[model samples]
Target: MSLIAWSLPKKTQLPAVSLLGNLFVLWFAPYAFVAMSISACLVYLISHAKSQKGHWVLLGVGYCISQFLLLRFLQEHSVDLGLGGSFSVLGVAYFTCRDVHYLVESYKGNVRKNIVTFWYYQSFLPVMIAGPINRYHEFEREIQRRSLDFDQISKGIERIIYGYAKVTVLGNYLIEHKIQSYLTQLPNQESILHSWLVSLADWAYLYAQFSGWSDVAIGFSLCIGIKVSENFNRPLSSKSLVDFWKRWHISLSSWCKDYVFTPALLITRNLFIAISLSMVTMGLWHESSLYYIFWGIYHAIGITLCRLYMKQDNEIVEYLRQRFWWSSFTRALTIFYLINASVFIGLFYDGLY
Candidate 1:
């Protein structure tokens, strides 16, 4: 797909290429294509609505209903739908977010209403499945400025190779096969050490898997002369939960911050409520289950505590901040907090005694 896009002479042909590629990919799952098309049309119409406030409410309700139905279907059927198991439910989670972003930005008068550009943004093959959730404006700008550059193509190829290595070698072989297998074989599976090990391995595998897909998406976009936002940045090295969110799944976090947190904060005028709503929304976006809700709440509590701690004016805090080892200590503490939180949740879901 990237090669085909790169070979096109006219920049105007880019969206067409994307459409073709998207159609081909969606051919096996026509329902997804139809659903996404309807969503795109609705967003377009809502963008041009007379009352911005009413349209915004409608968009919110529609988004929630659609997501709920999609998730319910996914959970009930566990349908692969096609794409050779590369994605389930045909990337509805991702493209739906993109559509909402467009609708919101359109409401804010930031995006121009062009169906072609909006469709292109929704179905762009590179970031279609696993996304950095490229914004419409950024994508349009890239489309306008794109050109076939050899250097960019070479770097893109390198990134793709690195991404596949992370997915297959690090995520699949080393972590899932070797480390997880060894951990599972331990004599005491319920031991603290075993749980922690399992959690750590799970976290590592998730990062490699997600970041690897992001890398591939970004690489493919680069190959087609478009640069997308990055999704991860050494999240495990973060010194606090707040810092970790800033570094982890950056696009989604920022989206939630902008769309969910800010709006909830303004409407409710409460910090805890806003943060909890945002985090829970993000968690539910991953999977609509009790486990994810608790996961979100756990992070919300961590973030709230971090914020409160930052508001303190104590000498001990100042002294710790000045220490050279403080950063390392906090980094380790943050990672430990996250791993154990996951372990706890896993145990709870698995019926802890």
Candidate 2:
């Protein structure tokens, strides 16, 4: 009698482990997990229906409308679905964006015939929460060359450590100290310096929390031999609000530029209308609320003005640019605008006013 032994390939091991991690994440967040599974299945089914042109696009739009309405219903009823009263779908926002990308590309006959690969690409746990949204073409290419070199592993580990430090140390410290609460009370105290301090703290805290999460996600994907796109790139140091957007949440911005902005511009043949459509879609994608619409409009105005300024051919503007303090002044102004505009992100129903 003989006992049989089985072993997995070196390259297959990371994805297998990742699948286990995905299972654990699902176990922890059952509601979000179920929602994700259903969405994945829907995309999978729709992918096979080549005869029906643009069906997946219709599905994507329908899903967005449904999610928006669900959010509104939940808000109106004061209901907590899951995960701190947010949408029960953990990565629905990211998931939908990916689905749209896949569908559009597939519709153009760019995708391959690999269901398992597509499944892993969609439900990969690292980016299931917040995303540096991955594209199927790049993901598939990476999967083919997956390896665990010492250098890659070390870089991945370093990213994870740095990201963990940012989130657990700096971000938590700011929150524990009640940065927002302090900002709220500064008006009553009438302390201008205190208000500035709290505002700066809030800004730093937001960057740490978001960029930290992105780092961790990208690091994990790297460990698994996939290089997810970078989400943040020293956005705080941006010279202009328009430059800030180009460096911040880069994957989402790229997606908007490629899928939404380009096509909208082509159809409308107007810069302002295209910018409005792209910005509003991006804003609403974050959360379904009138506040987000306003936030989108606010940024649209800022970006448009920046573009206009850059396009202007004025001697006064040229002279100002030559001044030693000009760049510093512009940077300072950009940061001030960012903080003021970002306050709208926290506003909801009553807070909207």
Candidate 3:
């Protein structure tokens, strides 16, 4: 797919190729294609609408409807409003984000009014499933100036290799097969050490699995001369809960910051409320469940506390901040907090008490 896109005769034809490729991929999941097509049409029409007093309201309504459908599809597993077949749209969460991003950017006069380009952005195959959520402007620019080069291909292949190793070896083999199996066979699964180990393993497995796929998506994009946004950046090594969010799932976090947090902050003028709303939105983006809601709130509280602590002017705090080992200590502390939180959430959801 990368080769085909890269080898296209005219750069102007890139969007058409991308659109066709995405449609081809979606053909396997016809219902998803239909759903996404409808969304694309709506977004295009909204983008082309005249600037009016109710423009923002229209965008809000469309966004809310899309999110509602995402949550409903997640809960019900199908459209099922007399749509004959019982099939749900695949990658609904991702494509919805893409559409909303396009709509918002279009409103801001940042995107072209080309429907083909819009559809290409919405259905780009590499980031279609697990995305770094490439912005439409960046994608359009890349499509125009893409090249078939050796160095880029080699780097792309290397990234893909690293991603596969992380997914298969670290996530599947080391964690799933070895560590989890050993834990399962433990005599005292309720021990503190056991719990901590489980938490660490689970966290590692999730990072490996998610970052691995992101790496693959990035590699594929790079192969075609389009550099998408990165998804992760050593999140476990972050110095605080606040810092962790800046590194982990960076695309989504940044998106929420721009689209949710900033807007809420502007409206409410309250730091805690903004952070809480943003985190909850991020959490619900993964799944519309109480577990994820609490997961988001847990992190939001931690982040708020971290932010508060950073504002402290105490001498002891200053002394600690100036120490060489302070960063290492804080990094470890952050990882510990995240691990325990994950464990607690897992236990709560699984009723393991």
RMSD of 2: 4.8
Mind giving the per-residue lDDT tens digits that candidate 1 earns over 1-353?
67677666675567667778578657755666667777777777778777768657466648744764675566457766564533335677777778778777877789886777777787788888786988888889998888878999889989999998999999999999999998878898778988788889999999999999999989988988899999999898798999999999999999899889999999999999999999998998887778888898888998999999889879999999999899898889899889988877777778933
* Model 1 ranges off by over 4 Å: 50-53, 64-68, 74-88, 350-353
The C-alpha local distance difference test score for the whole of candidate 1 amounts to: 0.82
Cα lDDT of model 3 by residue, 1-353, tens digit: 66576666765446656776577656655766776777777777777777633466366547645665664554466445664554555677787777777777777778767777676787678888786877888888887777777898889889999998999999999999998998889888788788898888888999999999999989988887778889999998798988899999998998899888998999999999999999998888887777888888888888999999999989999999999799899999899888888677777778944
Q: Per-prediction RMSD in angstroms?
A: 2.8, 4.8, 2.6
* lDDT against the true structure, each candidate: 0.82, 0.74, 0.80
Best by lDDT: 1
Better of 1 and 2 by TM-score: 1
Error of 1 at 78 (Å): 4.3
Error of 1 at 339 (Å): 0.3
Instruction: Put down candidate 2 lDDT per residue, 1-353, tens digits, no spaces.
Output: 00000136664664575576578657665655665666667766676675746855677657755754574456557677555634445666787788778877777788886888887787677887876888889988887877656577668779988998888787886663566666666555545455456667777887888889999888877766678878999887788878988898898998999888999999999888788888998888877778778778888888888888888779999998899799889899998877766454544444736
lDDT of 3 at 14: 67
Clashing pairs in 3: none
